[model samples]
Each structure stands twice: as C-alpha cells, then as structure tokens.
Target chain A: MKKLLKYDYQYLKRTSKFIIFPVVIIILAVLSPLTARYLNEILAFSLGDQAGMFNFPDPVVFDSYVEYLSNLSDIYLYVIIFIGVGTFINDKTKGLYPLILSKPINRVKYLLSKYMTLSSLIFVSLMVGMLVFSFYTYYIFGEVDLLNVFLLSLLYFIYVELILAIAMFSAMYFKSYITAVMITFAGYILVSLINVFSFEFLKYMPGMISSNIIQVISNSASTPDVIYNVVVTLVITGLLVVLSITKFKKYDLN
Target chain B: MDAIKTVNLSKSYNNTLVLKQLNLNVKKGEVYGFIGKNGAGKTTTINLILSLILKDSGQVFINEEEIKFSDLAFKKLIGYVPDVPVFPSYMCAKDYLRFTLDIFDLGDSMVNQKTEEILEFVSLPNSTKKISSYSRGMKQRLAIAQALIHDPEIIIMDEPTSALDPIGRNDVMNIIYKLRGSKTIFYSTHILDDVERVCDRIGLLDDGNLIVQDTVDNIQKNFFSNKFYIETKNEPKFVLKKIAKINQVQNAVKENHGIVCYLEENTDENTLLKKLMEMDENIVEFRRVKTSLEDVFIRLTNEKTT
Candidate 1:
C-alpha cells in the first residue's frame, strides 16, 4: 500500500488534473453564491430597470446555498467524471501497465491504489473549493451555519464517489477515456430521462440525491431521506467497484 | 536447479493459437536468448513468464519455485524491461528510481546506495530534467536502471537494444555483458547478431513451439557445413575454374564479393590450400565457412512452416 501511494503521489504531484479541478471548482464555488446574492444588481447592470421583466425573488442566505448546490450538481459533476475517466486509460495507452503488472503487486492492490488516489484528490479539491466559498459566504452574508455546511459537504462527497466509480468503471470497460466520459454522461442522460416520469421512482436516480441533500441542508427533508439516498448511492458504488476489479484482473495488460 | 523453466505453455488470442505446447530450460546463471520473428509469439511467451498475461496451459518456474498470479515472491525475483519502456515522463531520473525502490521496501540507506551504484553502472547522466525531455536512448538506459534497482535474480528484457542506434545498442550490450555471471537474463530478440555476441545459449521459436535450444556452439555444430569462403582480388571465373578441377573439391561458385568452395567428404584444409597455391591465385582471405545462428534460425523456421 505504501509503495502504491508513492507511485500515485508522484503522479498527483505532476498532473495538471489536480490543479485544474480545484481552480474550476473554486471559481464555481465563489461565483454561485455571488451570482445568487447580486442577481438584482447583475440584471440591472445588464438590462437597466427593464430587468423588472422577470419575477425575481429577494436574495437571501439560503438562496446562496441553494444556488451553490445547484451549480455543483449541474456543472462540477461532469468535471469529476472527465477526470475520473483518464485515470486508468492513461495506464493502458502509455504501455505502463505491462511494466507495473510485471512487478510483484497483485491486481486488487494495484486497482485499489489507483481508486484511492483519484478519489482522494477529487475529494480534497472539492473540500478546498467549498472552504473558500464558506469564507466568502460568511463575509458577504453575516454568518452561515457550519453544521449545515458540513452535512451538505458530506452528501456531496458521497455523490462524487458514486459518479467517480461510474466513470472509472466505464474507463475500464471501454479502454478509452473519451469514450468513458461519453458513456458516463450518456448514462446520466438516460437516467435523467427515466427520472422525468411522474412516479415514486424519482428518488432512486443518482441525480435526485443532490436535491435530497440540499433539502436536508435547508431543513426541509428528514435525516431518513438523506440515509435512503446515501444507502442507494453506496450500494451502486460498491457494485461498480466490484465489476471494475473483476474485469481488471482478467485484463490482458500486454 | 534451473534459473527459469517453462513446461508445455500454450496461449491463443480470440481462438487463434499463438503458443503451442512450448517448453524451455535455462540453467542458473546462463544468458538465454529467445529468438523468434514477429508474429512468432516471442512477446506472448515473455508476457506469460512474467504472468502479465495468463497462459492457456502449462507452468512456469523461476529458480525452481513455480509461479502464481497472486504470489509476489516470484515477482520479487524478476525485473522486466520492455521494448519501448514508458516512464511517468514528469519525473526526473532520481525521482523515478525512488518510486521503484520504494516498491521493494528497501531501507533508506540501501535505496540511496543502490540508486547511485545502478545509475553509475548503466552510465546514465545525472540530471534534474524530467523524463519527458529525455531522448529515446536516454529513456532506455533509465529503464535498465529501474529494472535492476531491486537487485532481482532474473531480468527479462524484450528487444532491449533493437530500437537503439549503433552507439546506444553498444551501450546496452556492454551493460548486459557486465552483468553476465551475476544475473540470469532471459533476453528476447529477433536480432541474431546480438545473440551471437551475448547469448550463452539460444532458443528458436517457430509456429508456437520451441524448435531448438542449445549452446551457441552446439547449434552451429548441428547445422555445420563444409563450405569454405574466400575473398580475393583475383578474377572470379578464373578462381571458380581453378578451384573446380581439384580432386577434393565438390562445387565452387562466385558469390557477392567472394567465392564459395564446397569440400568433398573427409577433405582436409592443407590439400585444398596446396592446390590453391599451385593455381597461383591471389588469396586475400580464406577460412572454413562458419554456420551462423541466423542460418539455423532460417532453416528451422522454414522447415516448420513448410
């Protein structure tokens, strides 16, 4: 495990992915809330008093949190997916796998190292972006609840883990990063299409978890609702990991 | 005990057989050269030995211990360098070596010491530049350093020098020569001249099986010929006629830049030389034609395919 860590840490140190992830997320983090707080000014600046064309609600602190979560779900999710897809595909294409597989490491240990490294980097990047946003959120709007923010961050972490697993699984399956990204997003679109039906099944889709999490943050959804979302996401993630490992073990590598 | 052995190993891809009941043996501390053409399953066999890919059947043993995919003990005994070794390209030479050394769990003291010795041994330049900036020859040298960092007993290399320029090829060959008795190397290549220069024994793989494995001398002797090669400034038609009339000479013909004379059974060199002197031809060079591994390789492979 330590050796795997050394290998991955060297990769993380040099990769532009780590740098890009945090910068993009930080921008989104600050922009979401700022956009929420100053929607009136932004509209008036661009449209004059004619911006009264739309029925805009008064800006509130809750509006900042809600808009931030919405931006995270809408835009930041695909960034995570694209980064996740490149993890294994690079190994295959670069002819590095034969050298690594030739070493004394087992398949499970190797795959685990890759998984942990990619996931942890994404996790750290998300936390750093959120921390920066928290400071700005407080500066702009008196004081936001730390406890509520912590719960929301935890929920977001769980959701990231799920999508990352999906992206990685697709990467392994297709053996191409671009194809993996396309398939992962395609899977997203397919599930979202299924989600549009008027049924009790809406809560089961992976995207619905974000809404449930935000509702939990806003004190509208029960803790049990959050648990249901967590349980389902974790279950799906567990299955994706198992599938990846099994397929990776059988991979020809050469 | 043999350093490496494979028994009836077989492999196929998508139902097309690539390796068929192949067997090989290399005694401890011997340089075993694996020679085969492209599409003759050289890389496939190497991959199976390292357990990079599963074999369809049969077993592999290193230093008498059988190999298993889950067991890393055998892996600890082996280091591999591919035809075109790929590095992180973002790391300097020292950083990349440090990563490989960490995998062996060596103490910091040993790591630092081996890093210096191995780098110096391969003769790579000490530099802070990233591997991405290194040329192909430089990368191959670093590949050797990484493979030897663990001090493994067996080193498997696939065409280590085939892609290098003459100077780089010489550098790689010199490194292999220096490691001769200390390490057992299973070198795979199609370059016969390299095998002639470095290998202690050779294996010829043709159509999914090992057609031959023996000492370099033995393979040459098995395919021995009585043909003699002569290169002279003398006229070719005159030399061919003068050589054809000798009682012991079977056939003589003009070759590119030389002449070939086949001696009759039990013919000796002195009797032929006397006739050559009597003919008074200007003999610039003369020697019994040596049967090269390349000849044996072509004959054996052609025979199998036909």
Candidate 2:
C-alpha cells in the first residue's frame, strides 16, 4: 500500500497533476477575492454614463468568502468531478489494469491509493487556496476571519470528497469517461434537488454541505445540523467507496 | 506439480458460452504453447487462470494451490503479459519497472540494478524516453522486461508477438528461448511457427475445448505419420493420377514439386514402391514427409469444424 502510494505520487508529479490542480485552485482563490473586491467598480466603469443610475453597495469580507466558496462549489467541484472520473476510468479504458492487477496487490488498496492520493492533493490545494483567499481578503477588506475561512475550506473539502466518491463510483459502474462524468453531474444535480425538499431528513443530505459551508463563512449555522450533514455525507461517501471496490473486484479486465 | 491447472473451467457472455469445460494443465519448467485461432478462448482461459475475469464454473490451481478470484499470493508466483500491454504513459521504462517492483513490495536497494538488468535482457535501450513515446515493439520488449523483473516461477503471455514485425517477433522468441528451462512459460499464440521453434509441449484449443495436448514431437509423429512425398520425372499431375490408382494409396494429391500420398493403415512402403515401379515412372526422390505444426493445426481445426 505504501509503495502504491509512492507510485501514485510519482504519477501525479510526472503527469503534471501536481501542478495543474493546485495552480487551478490558486487561480480560483486569487480571482475570487479580486473579482469580489472590484466587481462594483468594474461594472460601473462598463456602464460609465449609467454608473450613477445604480447604487453599488460596498463589498465585504463575507462577500469575498462567499465568492471563494461559490467558486469551490461550482468550478472547483467540476474540476474535481472531471479529473476524478478520468483518473478512475483511465486505468481500465487505457488498458492499464491488466498489468497492474496482474501484480501482487490487493484490489482494495489499489483503489484506495488512487482515492487517497487525489484526495490529499485536493486537500492541500484547498488549504493553499484558503491561505491565498485570506491574505487577499485581509489586504482588500481590512478584516479576515482566519478560523471561519479555515472551517469553510474544510467544509468545502469534505464536499469535494463526496464529489470524488461519486466520481469513483460512477467510473467503476459506467466504465466510460463521458458516461461517468455525465452520471456524476447527474448525481450532483440530484443531490442539489434533494436539498430543496422540505422534509426534515433532507436537511442532512450531502447536498446541504454547500449550504453548511456558507453558513460557516457567515457564522449563521446550527452546529448540530452541520454535524449531522457531515456525518451523513461521510457515511454516504464510505458506502460509495465500498460499492466501487466491489464492482472493480468483479470487473473483467479483458 | 503443474505450474498452472484448470479443471472444468467455463465462461459465458450474454448467454453465449465462449469457453466450455476446459481442462488445461501446464507443467512447471516447460514452455506450453496454447495454440488457438482468434476468439478461441485462449485469452479467456488466461484471464480465468489469472483471476482477471470471473469464471462461471470450475477452478484454477497454481503450484498445487487452488486459486480464488481475490487471491493475491498466487499472483506472486506468476507474471502476465497481455496481448496489448499498457503502462502509465508518463513513466519511462525504468520508472515503470520500478513501479512494478514497488507493486510486488520488492523495493530493495538493488531496484535500479535489477531494472537495468531486466531492461538489458529484453534488449530495450536504457534511455529515459517516456513509455508513451515508445513504438509498439519497444513497448512489448518493455512488457517482457517488467514481467521478468521479479523472476517469477511462471510467466503467462497472451500473443506477445502477434502484432510485432518479424524482427520484433524473433527478438521476443529469442528471449523466451533463453528462459526456456528456467521458467514455466504459458505462451498463447496463433503463430504456429514460433510455437514449433520454442515450445516443448502444446495444447490446441478449438472453440474453447482442449482438442489436442502433447509434446511437439509426439503430436507431429502421431498425426498423419504415413504421409509420403514422391517426386518423379513425370508431371506431378500425372504422377498423382497414377498414384491414386494404387490400392495402397488411400489419398494422393499434387503438391508444389511432388505428389503427396496418404497410405492406408498397415500398407507396407515396399508394396507401394513396387507398384510405382510397375507403372514405369522414373522416381527422382521418394521419402516420408514430416508433418508440420501448421499442417496439424489446420487439419485438426478443419476436422473439428466439419
């Protein structure tokens, strides 16, 4: 398992995954705060004559957090879904499984290695993104809640985990990159749709993770509800991982 | 003990049986050529033996130990090279071999030395070109290199040279020849000529059934041993026609430069020779023909189909 981890790390490094991922997240981090800070002026400049017609409210540190969190849930999550599906399915599609599986490696560890490696990359990239967002937020807005940003990043990272889990499950189930990506997107949309339901149980679904992340940034969340959502998401992620491994074990690498 | 054994193994796809109850045994320290045509379940059998696919019925054994689908220990005893071996494109040959070593938990201090030594065995250059940039032949050499890195007791290859040029094929065949006595090689291929050159024993599979299994010499000797080639001064066509008239000649046909005759069972060669002299045909050369592996494969497969 440790050797597999080393190979996965080497894979990430040689494949430029080590650079592309963090660079993308850091770009989002820098752009989020910059966009949140200057949107009003930029928009006003665009509407020069009509600039006075609309009063633009001042952007706050909360808006920067909101921008960053929104980017994480939208763009960053899509990146995760696409890359995650590719990583999971490419081994099978590209004919890499027969060689790798022919070795004396456990199926469970083979799978977890990829998941853990990619998840670690995502975690580190999120942490780096948080630091960048906080620095920019402090420089521009003069106030940055480090703990809230940290918590928000951590919450968003958990959501990233769920997305990756769904991606892995979809890749294993569908075995086609496009189909896996489409299925993961469908799963994302289905979870979000469940979030709109009025049922009490629906509040703890994985979809509520995005809202919980926001509540953390704005300091308006119920601690118990947040805990419940995290627990339920973790449980679902675990189940999906189990399902992926089971399917892969039975899969014919012909 | 057999290095690899399959008993009553069967597989189906979409309700169509691709592999029937196949009983195959590959003995240790021998080159077993698994000869089959396309879609003859050769790869399927390999997959089942390696636990790469689920078998609908029966069991596989390696070194006398029954194998399960999830068995990893058995894998340590065997190495596999697929029909089309693929590697992580981002890695060079040394990197990929090192990764394979890591997979087997053989990441010792001699990893670099072992990698270089195996690479040299396959005749792969020691350059650091990424595997993605390699040609098909180069990838195949690298595949063999990686498979031998751990010095496994058994090596299973599926059509390793089916897609290579003559030179590449010869290179792979030479490597197999070099490893012949030291390792058990379960080589799967439709290339009968290579099998004739390298394999000690063979199992011919037709429609998933083990139709024939024996040593190369025994199979050839047992199959159509009475076939004789007669070259005469007369036209081959006329010779064939006259030969067909002989009672001892059960069948006669004109070949490229001679008349080939299949003598009836218990027919003496002297009887046929005397009758040929009676026809007043000047015989230039007359000798028993050695049946080739190709001839045996084609005739057997055709007979099975008919």
Q: Proportion of native contacts found in each model?
A: 0.77, 0.98
> lDDT tens string, model 1, A1-254?
86886677667668877687788879987897798889877877789778778777778778778887878777888777777777767788677887777877777778778888877887787788778778878878876877676677778888788777787788788866678889888866765575466567557656667677778877898777678768887888889989989988888764
- Sorted into a CAPRI-style docking class, model 2 comes out as high
Q: Candidate 1 chain B: minimum summed lDDT over ten consecutive residues — where?
A: B221-230
**Best-matching candidate per TM-score:** 2
**In candidate 2, what are the lDDT values of residues A1-254, reduced to their tens digit?**
78878888888887787887799989998898899999999999999999999999998888898888888888888888888898888888888888888888898888999999999999999889889888888998899999999999888888888889999999999967999999999999988788688798699999998888888777889999999999998999999999999988888875
The i-RMS of every model, in angstroms, reads 1.4, 1.1
Estimate the Cα RMSD of every predicted model relative to the unseen true structure: 3.3, 1.6
Off by over 4 Å in 2: B233-235, B247-250, B255-257, B265-268, B277-284
DockQ, model 1, C-alpha based: 0.65
Q: TM-score of the candidate numbered 1?
A: 0.91
Best candidate, DockQ: 2
